[model samples]
Target chain A: MSRTSSDAVVVHQREPFLRGFGSFVADVWAARTMLVSFVRKDLMIRYRGSALGIAWTMVKPLVQLLVFSLVMGYFLGFGDQIPAFGFYMFTGLMLFGLFADQLTGGATSVLWGAPVVKKVAFRRELLPLAAVGGALVNFTFMGVVLLLAYVVTRDFPNWHMLGLAVPALLITVLFGAAGAMLVSALNVYARDVQFLIDVGLLLMFWLTPVLYPWSTVQNTLAENGAPSWAFELYMLNPMANAVVAFQQALWPGVDEAVANAAAQRAAGEPFIADFDYFDSAFATRLWLMVLAGAVCLWFAQRVFARLQTGFATEL
Target chain B: MAADVLEPGVAVSVEGVTQEFSLRHEKTLKGLLVSRLRGRHPVAERFRALDGVSLQVPTGSTMGLIGHNGSGKSTLLKIIGGVLTPTAGQVRRRGSLAALLELGAGFHADLSGRENVLLNAELLGLSRREIAARFDDIVEFSGVEQFIDTPMKFYSSGMFVRLGFAVAIHAEPDVLLVDEVLAVGDEQFQAKCLGVIRRFQQEGRTIVLVTHNMGDIEAFCDEVTLLHHGVVRAQGTPRTVVAAFRGLLAEDERERRAQSAGGRDDPEDPDLGFVRVARVVVRAGSGRPLDAFVAGDSLVVEATFHAERPAPRFVGTLDLYEGGTLLHSTSTARLGVPVGPLEGEVTYRFTLPDVPLGGGRYRIAVGAAPDTGSPPWHQVGDAAEVMVALRAESSGPFALGVTVDRPTRV
Candidate 1:
């Protein structure tokens, strides 16, 4: 490690490729205080003048969960077959909220921090990373809400739940951070990337099976004699596996028979009779998604390091 | 020449730094795509804002960067401050660095003054504990203690600059780069800011300043660099650099006036059939043409006019100017000098008993008008030049002698 000296500061033309990436991360680590301060400022300014203040962080996710459950359970009438249907939906919705917040926030971080990016000399990666950090703070609040919903519905979590939930949340945050870095770097030169992300997020939401159970999609594919590759491709979306992991972790004892019968009547089809979320097959897929998330993060960091050299001029 | 040596104690060294900016004709993706379809390049031009500029600053020395607008002084400063990366070469500095490149450059308008101070200090590389320790002193120095909690958006622009300057200086940087931000706030605060800068110099810190005020450069800088067209035209002591800058300005002004006179004319305003100023001259009392003089020397200005048409009366005015600023104007009517009816060519001379001016270069503006309260028939700016040697140090537009008497007992 190179020791920092107050007596000397050397500035040179930025190098490209791997050498630049290494120094960029080192610079960010040295300015960790700035990153932390930016995250705090982002969080504070977000709820500064509102009456409910930070409570909105929880209230927003809670209200969305309530509306989705009530409409699907009462108005659309899928409540009877599935035990603890609200808890089931809440788990997926909270996780999706965390992912969506980071996706949009990180993508716009550079444009939003134009003032500092154009004027100050620091690691520009901190801007998008801070956005991810801010989203994580909000996600933590929603996590508390998710636990409360499980408790109120009489779905007590066990040790296996803790083991899955920790890794699930970590993978989701990692994936979101990676996605944020990629989009934010592109958005600096082409602002159309920001709007493209909004459309992408909407499309990914339905694909990820956040509101509907993954078994329903699986049953539809099986009954139609669809190609096995269809099911495989659907699971390839990291968020799809993330949502399932979160659901299995939060909704313990998910009464397989009742859920299959409810899913059948709701969609007028035969749902999968035996679905094991904690089976080795599902765990391997979850771990694969975690690996994919790490790869994405590494790629994003490299792209961010390369793109940031022009940020001062572009902004 | 002596200051050009690079010693081991050099605080900042800039070597062959070149900066180029692409001037894109299209800023949006749609415009860029349209241009591509039309087979037009997106970059309309490439501007070299800095061209192989090199300089070395010794430890504890103050360097002033003086240039006209778009001369690359600010760009050099930004490169040295690390806010910009040159396309070629590099800048190496020894010591902790802080730059006030632009006043309130990093401040968040929605954040309070106190929050902004903490945020800016940390961005400038101060630790949280350091900011906490110096928080009170920063606020006191800024003189915004009463409104410290108010959001910066509500504060006056002067307050914003004051708080920014305070936090920057309090960071205790070993090398400071300042742009022309000191031209803010009241005169008293500006003086206080200069005092702090002087104290920084006394403490053996390196300072790089960019300002248009020649007086500041003369007073503060140990050495000065004059840039023109993205290149260093002169660099040395303040006097030599300032003189070169003034020469550049005079040449630019002369070229501008000649270009305007050559091709531009107000066609709607026909030439009035009256006397017009033809030539102007300045001479010493000893009957010799003079371009330079000392204070308290007798001087005379002679103006010759040609009357294209007969006029009942005419008045010619000789105006003295320093740069673009008009200093003194004496008209035949105002000075109570007699002017007979004008016909053909005529000459008039105005005399000053003593040239009540200080050191510096100046120009003359001559105008001839009919006594009919109409606009001047012809006016020629930059009619002549005068250089006055400094006799005693003084401020303001001109020099004045003064004396002081001391009482035996107080």
Candidate 2:
């Protein structure tokens, strides 16, 4: 084995504020193989002993869809009002599942990797990043299951709007990564952060447009005489925008419901309400929020870099 | 900070590195909030583990760090390995580095040995291609090829440590930081590890080792540094530095004995100040006072006693002990040596010819009795200590030299 003359010489000290970002990013990039190893380990260990193995990943989402379709479609009498209501609801929950998995898994990533973290010297950010990777794998499996459901029902989604899901998933991942880095580092100091994240996620589930579509929230706000900025503020949540984007991509009835509402309004007949999937400022707000999420992720990474110097000692 | 400029031969240089840890009094958030609400601020207790410690390891040289527990040897090693960022100062090192701080520290119990080796080698800064190339060599060296696919939780502790050490040694780091992890597994494996370290030295890799086993230090270290209470006490050749460490240990033992006054000083003495054994000393045949000696060397024991009043027929006794067990006992009367009427201070000398002792510290005790079958006027336990180094390649409480004639088909 030949030793490279250009071997990097590292100088370790207490890093000043944002001074070592370039080298830190370089180190993270260099350790990408380790990140893949950790992600693979997590996925393999999660389903090592089960009878069905990786089939378990698809089982949970299918079961949830089955239960929701039975209770919400047949028992609630709303199946006639909305087409494929269970699938629409399942589409929103599927993306939200990715967010929730990333949040909780990333929050405990550092603590869970304590044995490796305390002994080895590598880019510690990989711990939380690996958790995000594992969540994305599960998200892929759920996406495949959703596609099969659409095929069985013979209701293809809007092909033109499906490209929105890419940016929507990107924003969700950014937000998840930001929250993960922030809490994972803080959790090393105080274990209460993990519990607080659990409660916060429960609250966030209702606030985001997961169980109900964005139109119901808009209808409620209009009836309550809320200001227009209130509508903008409600849509400011990244998860809310992600759920709407998923609906525009996967749920086939979004445009039909909008057309039916317009026709009913012209005839002066009672009709189920549905909002425009693409609002006037939708693209601008979507990309702007992506920018905002990137800024939050950068800031969280800085906080993580500063706090990680104490992890070995504190843990 | 400006970049450091190292001398040509220096591979690792630590400049005034100081590490301090703040130990928080409150462990939980709720407890911290409650204490703050009561207007009682729980202060963080700061502990300085390493204070202004600076050392340089030249390329291809092995340096050993020796100290009592909590003396910051491991902390310094961690700082050098970049596992910890020093609170102050900087550690600059060239080339790749790996720290075998704890065997199997990076292994997952649930993962198979093969998988763990892949992960662990990558964690130690090895590339995927490098690990794949050396995977067979690592498994062969570890001697666990039969169970390479089994999860580590099922492996024996010895097998686990062997595999961990095997993977780390194959990482091909330019500088290695080892912290007392060499004395794992059985003796055969330890020797194998030592052989690998010797090969590393031959290949001109710098090593910084931390261990309490002075034998390992003396055997492997080119130079040694002694740390006492987070400060470097001495640094130089292994012989001088290890001697200084021994002196420090003896001083600590003296201080501990002095603190437990009840055991060192007899309180319920009826003949309180009538007579007392003032001191005891051990000397070589050349009349030189030495705390260490080779086995089978002539030793002279001298005990000085002081009497306030006239006392006749006083008997003096000398006892040699090893760790609370008495090995030999002799008295002036037993040896046919008589003492005069004791009125003032008197010194009694006992000569031992060709003593056979093993490699360990032996304590000497002396006492003065009024007469045979009478309570001792004064006695001192742990009066002095002498270290006996083995003369031949032998072990145990006594070093015995043996000879065997060639067997002729008997």
Candidate 3:
């Protein structure tokens, strides 16, 4: 608050290479209050006039869970063998919804706040960060719905659920923030990127094991005589691994007989899979995914900083 | 004042700051790719909006930037405000800063006026606690108390600007950057806003204002900088800088007139060259041609037309303009005045029995056209310049006679 010092703030050309990254981090940290305000405003304005308001957050995922469960569990008869198919699908859908929302929202964050971005001098990264943060808030609301589903079904979560779910959720958010940062910056130059992302998210939703489990993918690969590297490459998708991690945390008591039967029925079907929740190799791969996500976050921050220099002109 | 005396500080210092923007001709990847396939490189033309401009602002003085459009006055202000970063050099500031770079720049239309006040204040760098403490005062200052809870989309533009200005001034930053936002709103509100800014000046806050209004620059600024083509052309006390700015503007206008006159040899419409407006003269009712006239005096505007090819009929139009705003316009065709067939030269005159205009510099524009659905044969803007002197104190575009009456002792 003191205004008398001449040396308090100096803005100069950033140092070349990675040296300025540290200062960038420090700047973002200093503007954390603005970031929080942005996120709060984003969430409030989004639901301001809606009758359902914040309830729409929970309602969207719940509806997605019911529709997927009804189609895959009844008509398709794929979920007949998976015990508590609805809850399993809900966990994956919840995580996927959070990831998708963050990605799309992050991509448009800068463009959406063009008025502020062009006129105000602040940490521009806060825009995408707020977008991801707002998605996380919605994710928390859906988490409550998940908890409610657990109580209704008389299924209880153990301490291991906390141990695993918290890290899974964090990793998902980190991945989302990274993706949002990259796409949002790209979106400023190419409006086509927004539409590309819409199509990409649809493809990614099917690619990830949101409605199904991971086992079906593996079994189908084995049956098709595909090489093992294909399955490894498939597992390398961070969202695929994150979805498995979320399922493991939320639906640990899946009936194996029913799961296998559903797996048998879902053979050769797109987006139907049964995951191995306790696979040591999958856990290791999930850890690697988290590390990769962190690296991506770092890279995205650098790209965003470089692109943001021209945001005012571009906007 | 205490801080200024204690520190003798420089509030803002710009050192060799240059802002370069890459103007991309192709914004889409597909367009870029198509250009690549055609053996052409997608071009990004670099423009230097601010070219190594450096200045030092003392802690407690108000500085005004004056320039024509695209002269980079706003760019310099933005750079100082930190809304834009220079591509080279550096900027150092002594204290917290708030910028009114654009009025209502970030207010959400769907949000109520009260909500936008909080949002805009915080965006300007005020903390939530500070905004909460000063909310009532901000609202009162804006005079939008009745519409505080109404969505901003429903509010008038004046209300929006008032609220935006109110929040910005209340932010109490050490350095304030304002960019022509005072040009909006009513006269009373504009005066109120300027009063707050004057108060800020008295409190020793550093202010940098960008405006095209020479009056404002003279009235408010301790010093002035006049920019031309992204560089400072003049910098000194308000009087010297404003004079230089006006000189530059007049020079520009003269060059533009020369160019336009040279280029007008080829008429767009073939029939337009049949007749041309040669001269325009303005005279008082006393029959003396004068450059300046007093309000309520009878004025006569006469335009002479020379016809190269005989025209069957013609309509002469006269227009009076103050600055860019047209005050009054009349056409002989509209007034049912008859016109011309025979040709060498003809003079048409329109008389205003009482010039109702208030004091201001004014221009007379004259044009002539074939009366039968053809484009104007010749049109001349500012064919004659006249100054209207105020007979008495007045406001607005015109002065009307007023009668004051006292209430009867019923």
Q: Which predicted model would earn the best TM-score?
A: 2
Per-residue C-alpha lDDT of model 1 across residues B315-335, encoded as one tens digit per residue: 888788775567987788788
Task: State in Å the error of residue B138, model 3.
Answer: 1.1
Weakest 10 consecutive residues of candidate 3 chain B by summed lDDT: B262-271
Every model's TM-score: 0.81, 0.84, 0.77
Q: How does candidate 3 score on lDDT?
A: 0.77
Question: Which rank order by DockQ, best down to worst?
Answer: 2, 1, 3
- Model 3 lDDT tens row, A1-315: 356554536643465555566777797788788788888878888899899987888887777777887898888886765667787788888899999989888988998788777766777888999899899898889888777878888876444655567667767988999999989999888878888989999998999987766777887898899998888888777888788777777774554533664666568545444544635665666677788888888888888888887787788
The sequence of per-residue lDDT tens digits that candidate 2 reaches over residues B1-410 is 24755566777888898899876756467866786698763345678999998888888899999999999998898888777888888887877777777565467788899988998898888888888899999999999999999998899878988887888789978888888777678888888989988998999898999988776786689999998988889999876787778668757754654465343132223333356788787787755455577677878888998876556556788888775468998788888876546778888889988888788777677887765544555667667667776555776678777667798895
Off by over 4 Å in 3: A12-17, A158-162, A255-282, B1-8, B35-44, B262-410
The DockQ values of the predictions, listed in order, are: 0.32, 0.54, 0.26
Best by DockQ: 2
Q: Indicate the residue-level lDDT of B266 in model 1.
A: 19
Binned by DockQ into CAPRI classes (incorrect, acceptable, medium, high), candidate 3 is: acceptable
Q: What is the TM-score of chain B in candidate 3?
A: 0.64
Off by over 4 Å in 2: A1-8, A11-13, A269-272, B25-27, B35-44, B102-104, B263-410
> What is the TM-score of candidate 1?
0.81
